[model samples]
Target: MLSTSMRPLTAHLCLALAGGAFTCGARAQQDPDGTAVLDSVVVRSTKQERTLLQTAASIDLVDGQAVERQGLQSLADVAQQLPNVYFTDFTGSTPTLSLRGLGFSDDESDSLSTSVLIDGVPVYGNALGTLFDLDRIEVLRGPQSTLYGQNSMGGLVSLRTRDPGLQWGGSAQFDYGSGNRRRASAAFDMPLGERTGLRLSLGSEDADGHVDNRALGRSDTAGWSSRFARLKLLHTDGAGGEWRLGLHHARREGGNDFFVSTAQAHAHESAASDAGRSDTDYTLLTGEYQRALRGGQRLAITLGATEAHWNYWMPLSQYGGPSGFDSRTRQFSAEARLSSASAPVGGLDWMAGAYASRMDKSAPYLFEVPGYMRSETTARVRGATAAVFGELGWRLAERWRLAGALRLEQDRRRMDWASDQSGYFDSDGDGVPDTPYTSADRIDGLRVRDSEWLPRLTLEWTPAAEQFAWLTLARGYKASGFNLYAYTPSSAATPYAPEYGNHVEAGWRMRGAGNRWDLGATVFHTRLRDQQVVVIGAGGASLVSNAGRSHSEGVELNAALRPTAGLELRGCAGWVRAQYDDYVKGGEDFAGRQFPNTPRHSFGLALNWKPADGWETGVSVRRVGSSALYPDSTVTNAAYTLVDAHVSFRAGRWTLGLYGKNLGDAKYLVRALDARTVVAGAPRTLGVRASVDF
Candidate 1:
């Protein structure tokens, strides 16, 4: 039997499918040349540029124009339109992302299962702050370890920013919305010379959030403000050589009291006596040089450097006590590669690359429970990585192609940690601390080293133009790390093992005649050894541990149709079953339990229309299924649906738009730590935006 939430989604899917069938048959008889074809999207996820239709991997591409039109502000907004993707934003600095049920649920910055790339440079922590002036976003599903090394076991998100154009032009936009939200952005491009160009973009946003704090008598307790600036310079040598340099800086300050107890009657209401605060900032610099050689071959060298910092003080106890956290990270990376151009030479395509990176990080955490206890811990880590990777593709027959990729990687890390405990102690074991005590521990010169060989094989069959089918097998890996928040000496001394994944996937994609429609489906299965998971340790501290074994399997489907000129319909659905095979923690056996924070079902539908010149409208519906909040816990986040719509009018060089999100006013949980500590999702919001191009 279908649940109430599932019924609506099922109905929407059926209607979309039926409409597509009817439109396909009816449109086949019309003038094919008169109808516009779906635009072709070029992606560079595999270290090479290729059309999405020609790529032999499962990928989702989101256009920058669509992002602006629909007012998609963050990656979480974009995830709603994609299949088998989930995001949980626990705080401004800690965001958990998962693809195909493979990601960490807790606040572990060094153990991300999914990797986020900004212009080919990997980002260490959250990537939400850099969502401005984007050219496109490519989400590559499944493991990409063969090309991207570690931390890419689940998938990769690649964001490409817009570059300078040949002509001088600019655009400006302003937006106002609910909760006193305000946003302003501008982009300018200019030609410095015949062969050189430059682009600059600036944006800022501020909002008095929706959440109300009764204890503090505040209406917008979760408000936030952010600002970002980006600059790019492009120079062409006019001899098949080019040089590009980019600089980006972003900062965000917001309230850290987003979590509330689940027992509250309203998710957006809080009773905290202390209104917390958070601040984060990051700067990135990147440079690339590319040269074209003979025989359609190209050589490229890239360099990147990043520096980020985060600081926050949030209430951790019901008695209005605050806990403080501070983190700082720096990374430098360089890569050189050579690859064959888009046109295969002698029916063969190949690429080879070498990469090196160095990172330094330090974090300190202080937790206080008012008069009960206080613990402080500081950790410092230095890590280095080196890898060599290559990929080759061969034409086996007129309609068949075979490809293989391999990567040899080595990671080394050194750690220095210290922990201090003070305040009352439970000396009598009566669940009460009556004696005051103090203890301290230190760990130094601890080192970990890991080496892995990741490989992937794919067989593709192209039966017709714009049609492709492929099967792939790949291996993924994530390096080990120590627990930074450990309070006890034994817990601080322990380290988790590396995780390994074996994955298999099969997929098919096709476009209808005249490009009026398209359809794609994929099935995947993955098995993991020593899966990394978070567990509650002594003193109510969170620690990363390794699970014995686990597995995840799922199917994803997507379809799009243009029934008539100026009208389009799209739909996507996904189902996943992820469970543990053998796992025991703290004397509890959870062999067959489902993975936490992984939904079993998800679906989406969208309709876009252009009724007349200078007029556009669209609506989208998304449904997310229920899932457990923690391993072996009875508490679950219930299912919920969201609706978003937009309408715009354009005249001359000016455009105005009205958009609304979560129109149904649905209340849901985005993150939860048991029933007491929970973070609610955003509520309904409506806004208006205006933009002008010159």
Candidate 2:
């Protein structure tokens, strides 16, 4: 846990940093004839179009231009700029994501507490492959179950891709960095006809990673390569109707893990006996149709299908042989919605929608110990969900508005698992293998069903133009599931219960005159019941269980200032206290313990400067506070800070830039299983990039 005495100090330090940026901006001389105005940001995460200030939710927006300028390559990079958001990158099929201290931290590929959506469609498996050619990214904090449904018990990450334009144009970019890292991407947009257009995007990235493996005689133990392509076709009927179809495919191959024993001489050095590798392929297809209706109403429908396949082999023990896992997942989803127009009709605005989805997954697990033991497990799971949701907003007065939303959802899952093993056993309990045993076990037709009613209510007051305050109450839920890697019938037959949360938040946002400055603050609290947690079962197997009660409370602040022309400053800070309220496991009480993998304090500051017409420069700083790494242990990850900067110059249709990350070369842990083995963060990196437009 964070020291109580240090909490106030951390808050003060973050405030001081933000104040310094604001002070610098204020002191700069303003041009007599030119003035800077902040651009208005629009979001569609709510299934409705609204400005950031007008939306009654705790939200963060990252512009696509900022992504390009800062060289934000992955979701982890984007999380640096948002308050109360964290991403944990591991050498597994999926990374863990958390918002405001609530998240899924296990290796289960079918479950998510914070869901990711691409253009309003939920994406299963790895979402990292869809991070390019984006128009914008929106992070909606807190429960969004009323609109997003299950798996969104924490929040939602919405990535909107660029649309096909009517004009014919194209752009290409290339980047070269330290560790022999290389990246190339290109995009083209063209008009197919007077009312139709087509767009295509392609990208590839590869790098010789930083870790060194002595046993394998390899310097790129964690290196990886990936390629992706996307295509979209759009048509307008000129009668208030439109249609769009999209296809995306991505593939990745390489080493995924670099675990070094703490006894090793260097942090970036590993001594594993077996080389671990991972390969993945993902493909998605989507179709959308929208039509304007009479009486200020509109109808929209969306259909999506996705397939993902992943295979990996990793070393489980320091000296033992490697283990392998193979998974293939496919899902189909459809949704239809009818919404009132932007303009109010009869002092009311409303929306109603229905959603349905089906997913099928098959995963095979293998454990091998060269000459000692071997085990294999085959598992298959099928899940289906359906939901109906509606929201209504009513203006009580000229300055006050009230809104309510509700969603009824049902989820069902079925699993079939079988395991076979042959190994030496010590039946006499003399610490020696006296018997050779071969056994087979099967658990078939195991099923789980869950239903939940999620609701949200809000009250908003427009105290004045460009200023807003709101209070909200919401309920969140996560569906139940069985352990996919269970090696025994007992663990395979057990299913975890659904997790639920009640949340309350109050927030305020304001914009200065001419949009020269803006600030937003929010305070929130959430209480959870039946929190799902991973624990060590009999024989050292991992299992998911409905643990105990918990709560998370936090305060977040964000500010942006354009004190002078050609210079802008932005800062965000968050403080959270998340702890178990009543948790006991294996005859030990863990109540009041802080949640694992959740930071106590987070802060970020960024400044962008464009002194001349063809020149641009920017610098950003991020700080994360210390926290425990596991629920059953006191081991903690110390606080760390990182600095990144970039500078670029544009000449007509061509541009060149230089960027650096982790300039301080800080050594930190991205993941750790124990004191002996750990995964280290990236070292210092510098890169140059060039781009051309045609």
Candidate 3:
């Protein structure tokens, strides 16, 4: 697999080099821009926006130019090229992104370790990260729980979208790929008035799944389609007081596809051959205003509101006999923030803000046939936080710079549950008692309850011009909620305790002109308390509880070298040792068991060459290490590798591109566990795409 993955890369390099020589020879005759292109590269991995060489964090920033060049479809594909970043897609639709080894599963019952942000508005749902139109993606490793809050205890994925400037421009793209896949995307920025601008983006995609479903006489069951549209309006009074409003909407429809082995097919033959998939719709509106205070001070106020609705279908016949389950969830959130750029202390650039946020969630689960018994669940989260953050580039002893920050926050989460019928009702009126419904035995009736003070802090030190290093320590938390499906008459009504964590990290970075190369590495350890884990009994019932503590440590390396002016090479690799610290099972402590679904090793590399004659080409290769099932499963999947390539011809405002993804056609599982199993990463897909700018 590795050799095949490398072959396409080798071929692309030769083609790119040949193309570059011809283009360079012609370009030499033209005048060159004396201005340096330093701005083309960014350093968003860290909170501070410095050059890659100036920061100590191991971060990767994929800019809009790079995103366009690759014709990437989702965050998983984009993250695969970054060292220490791991991403997987169960279907072409859902992508799970993780930095270092701290992130792995996207279980609804588990807390998220990575926080995804869209245009500074943090998005926290399972669907938000799938949207593709973005200006840049910032992958910050280690604990960002302080600045980012909660799930960021592991890492963060912040996506910054394109801004509408003082120009009128727009771009549109269309593509038809293999397997009847069709896609279209377009965006425009125009002046609304004398001091106002408006920008809009729209995209739609549809494709057929690759897996074959013999029961349904179809070769595809994972097919999905999505549509997204967004609008932004900005107004500036030329006095540092600017107000902006943004509105966005998106929808997704899809199902899980897994090819079963011959052994599993003969046993009970329980599977969903014709079940509908999960569907979700998201809508949001946000506004922000900024103005100048006194004495070179600035102030900014931001307000946001969002609502998301999700509908999921579970084919119980696939699990047991013929049973069907459906769940609906509605979420609403609102937040306000006021920040100022003022420092009472000398040599400090400080920002202080008071923030409040509220979130409400409701979900109802019901049986499709027989006696429809409905169970309803709800949760409310309200929190207030006061934070003062400052980064001081203290120029001590010439080239040395020191930086540090502190954050303190408090959050309260409450959960409630109610039901019309116990858990199950005999709707069919059959004396045989259709299917044994969820038996509420030895369980406390569901009610409402609350939990409260999450806190965090960070510090960094850079020594001189040739070296940089930093150490960080922080705390993180995840609120607790009730599970309706896991509830019975004997179930406990009070919500479970929230998870907590203490994370520590240290790293080093070095870069210079010698080889015109940049390199960075980091090691981190985390101690988690009240870790949420699934508990099961002999009857195959499920419940969430504070199982046991765990520890994780990992090392990451990233390097980008410009061997020559026209050629650039980038490589990233990571290794992690994540395990249960004190987990007790079957009367013994399984302290060293590896975390389920967490890859031990992963790496990726990319090479891009720009030759003369408006031509460009690139190739990339990525590898994911093997992982095992949770709860002491003896089965483990082998590792897998993938390859991708791109070639484009550009002239003026028009460009034509050809791309091939998963070129080696490696067959591997992107996500797999009990409940719903998914297999086979997206197959090698080839397509031609065109883009025009005006």
TM-score of each: 0.92, 0.92, 0.81
Residue 593, model 1: lDDT of 82
Instruction: Report how far residue 52 has shifted in candidate 2, in Å.
Output: 1.1
Better of 2 and 3 by TM-score: 2
Best by lDDT: 1
State candidate 3's TM-score.
Answer: 0.81
Instruction: Give the clashing pairs for model 1.
Output: none
lDDT against the true structure, each candidate: 0.72, 0.72, 0.54
User: Where's the lowest-lDDT run of ten residues in candidate 2?
Assistant: 4-13
- After superposing all C-alphas onto the true structure, candidate 1 shows an RMSD in angstroms of 5.7
- Tell me the spans in candidate 2 whose CA falls farther than 4 Å from its real position: 1-40, 45-47, 125-130, 149-151, 263-266, 315-319, 342-346, 428-430, 630-633
lDDT of 3 by residue, 1-694 (tens): 0011000000000001111111100111121422112233444321323465454554556565555445556676666565556554433454656555444533333245676666555554455534555666667766663333223556777766666655798999887777666778899999977788888989997866565565676544666677988888889987858887888788878665442442332221224556445666677776767676666555555566666665654444343322223333332333332333323323444434444455555544443332533333332223333333333333333444444544454545444444333324355877544454553233323333333344444344555564577776666665564544443433334344666777777877765654456666778877888765544433344444554788777887766666655565666677778777777753556678776656678776777676666777777777777776332233355677777788888899999988887788766544433423334455677888888988
Instruction: Encode model 1's per-residue lDDT on 380-447: one tens digit a residue.
Output: 88889899988888876778878888888898888888988788978899988899988888999788
Q: Candidate 2's residue-wise lDDT over 1-694, tens digit each?
A: 0111100000001111221112211112235534444335566534465676677888766666556655566666666556777666555223446777776453453556887777667775354632578777778888886554334888888777788989999999898888787889999999999889999999998877777777779877677788999998899997868998989888877775565654451367777665577777888888888888887687888888888887776655443755767788898889888888653423888888889999898978877665566778888999999999988888778888788888899999999999998888778888877688788998888888988888889998898988889999999888887777767677778877888999999999887986688788999999999887766644546666776899999998877787877777878788988888998876767688777777789887878788888887777787878776542245466788777788889999999998887787766665555555555666787899999999
